[model samples]
Target: MTPVVSLRGVRVAHQGRTVVHAVDLDIQRGSWFGLVGANGSGKTSLLKALAGRLPFSGGACLIGGEDMIADRAGRAEQFGFAPPADRLPDSLRASEMLAFVGGHLDRVRRNLGPLRQALGVDPLLDQWIGNCSAGMKQRLAIAAAFAGGQKLVILDEPFNWLDPVAIFDLRLALRQMVDDGLTLITALHDLHALVVACDDGLILANGKKRIDLSHGMLRDAAVAPSLFEKEMIDILRAGAAE
Candidate 1:
């Protein structure tokens, strides 16, 4: 079967400086994929490119067999994204913001019931986004992302500001989504969560693709957190040395 998402020789640049080098990748259908990288390693850049927020300077991005850049509406219909916490609008109420971000998509409206139930957003609906606590904001953001019943969901730094209980709840929610055939991708620093949740993961260092770990490799790392942390650190170190 064709991959759900594909990147070929992709390159991204900002302000005349290249941030993501030529990179190639494929994300399978119905799988939870993880993107890992140190600060400024181009993880967000790649996600933005995939989300159509940023234009790619070279190569191609395909979503569900359609060229992502060339087929804007198709790409938009196929994926939903949750940006970082700091990027959410503070001016609107939680309900207003969620509506503003996802209201146009029919899938979002159709899928909102499950998201509302899972993220527990009813209490925060009337609250102004700026007034809500950090955890509240994060929960709303998550609700907004999963609200779209797109084939693929991309989330950046999803666990930020979440308490232990919220984190546990979110993980269960993600697992349920995957079980229901949603393709999930996230760029996160929570190594333990990544290992526990993702079937596959890629590590980026200095805008370069450094390592791709399969399910067994990721599961193995979970046996010892330090081992996985050390491996990520080593990848970054290697990139820095180059």
Candidate 2:
């Protein structure tokens, strides 16, 4: 089967500084994939590039085998992207923000009830975005992303302000979403969470691929936490030294 998402020699530069270098990646359909790296290592940049939010300087990215660069709108329609909470607008109410998301595709509006319940966002609908806490906003953003029922979801630093309980719920929700046949790619800081939630992991160091481990290669749940953390820390340390 063709990969749900594919990047070939993808690169991204910001203000003349290349942050992501020639990355080739393939994410299988319905798989949960984690992009792990230290701050500034280009995990977020790569995710944005894959989501077609940023134009790559070279190579190509395809969503469901369609060239993203050539069909920006069509490519965007295939995935729901939620940036970090701080990037979301502060002026809108939760309802307004959700409406904006629904405007993009009718599926979002149609699925509003179930998504709101799943994210525990029903009570937050009337709150002003600026007044909501970080965790609340994160939840709302996540809910809005899935509102559209897009086949692929891309989230950048989703755990930034989530409380412990929210984190726990999010893990279960994400796993359930994947089981329901949607592909997920998230940039996350927690190695343990990644191992628990994702079937595969990709490590980036100084904007380049350092490790790509599939589900079959990862250790069992019992040993994964320690082993994954050690490997990630070693890569970060090596990147810092370079």
Candidate 3:
């Protein structure tokens, strides 16, 4: 089967400075792929470029066989992106925000009921976004990402501001979604969560691909998590020193 997401020599730049170097990747349908990197390692920039929210150069980025940059409107329907909580609109009610972004509030609510319940965002739906706490906002942001019933969802630092219980719930929920045929891409800082949730992942260091963690490797890491984490830390530290 063709990959759900494919990138070849992908590069992203900001202010004429390239932050994401030439990179190649492929993610199969129904897989949960993780992006791991330290601060300023280009994870966010790469995610934005893939989602068509940022401009990129040097190669092709195809989502479901279509050019992501050229067919952004179609891509929006295929994937949902939940950026940082601070990017949500403060003035709108959570429900309104979902409707604005996802279109058709009723359909969004019906399609994303499970995710909303899992995220504990139902109570905040009627509340203005400005009044919600960081955790609450984060929950809403996650729910909003799935509001469109997208086949793929990309989350950046989704564990931020979430309590331990919420984190656990989200992990379970995301796993279930993938099992039910959702393609997930997440930029994560929490290695524990990455080991627990992701089937495949790669480490990014200084705008370059540092390590690719395959499914079998991650499965082994799941059994011996600390060893995996140590390996990642050693790599990251080495990358940082360079």
Best candidate according to TM-score: 3
In what order do the candidates fall by TM-score, top score first? 3, 2, 1
The parts of candidate 1 lying over 4 Å away from their true place are 71-74, 104-110
Candidate 3 per-residue lDDT, tens place, 1-242, comes to 89999988889999999999998888989999999999999999998878778877778888878776555556556778885798788889998998887787888777675686778767887999998999999998888888877888999998899989888888888898899899999999989888889989989999998888899999999899998889999999888777
Q: Please report, in order, the local distance difference test score of every candidate based on alpha carbons.
A: 0.81, 0.78, 0.86
User: Candidate 3: what lDDT?
Assistant: 0.86
For model 1, how does the per-residue alpha-carbon lDDT over 1-242 read when each residue is reduced to its tens digit?
A: 69888899899889999999988888889999999888898999988888777778898888778777665456656678875666678898877777677665454556764565667777787888888887888887777776656668888888888888778877887888787888998998878888888989898889999988788899889898798888788887898677
For lDDT, the strongest prediction is 3
lDDT, ranked from best to worst? 3, 1, 2
Candidate 2 residue-wise lDDT at 209: 85
Q: Where does the lowest 10-residue lDDT sum fall in candidate 2?
A: 105-114
In candidate 2, what are the lDDT values of residues 40-136, reduced to their tens digit? 9999888776666776788788877877755556666777888567667889888788778876434454554344555677688789999998888
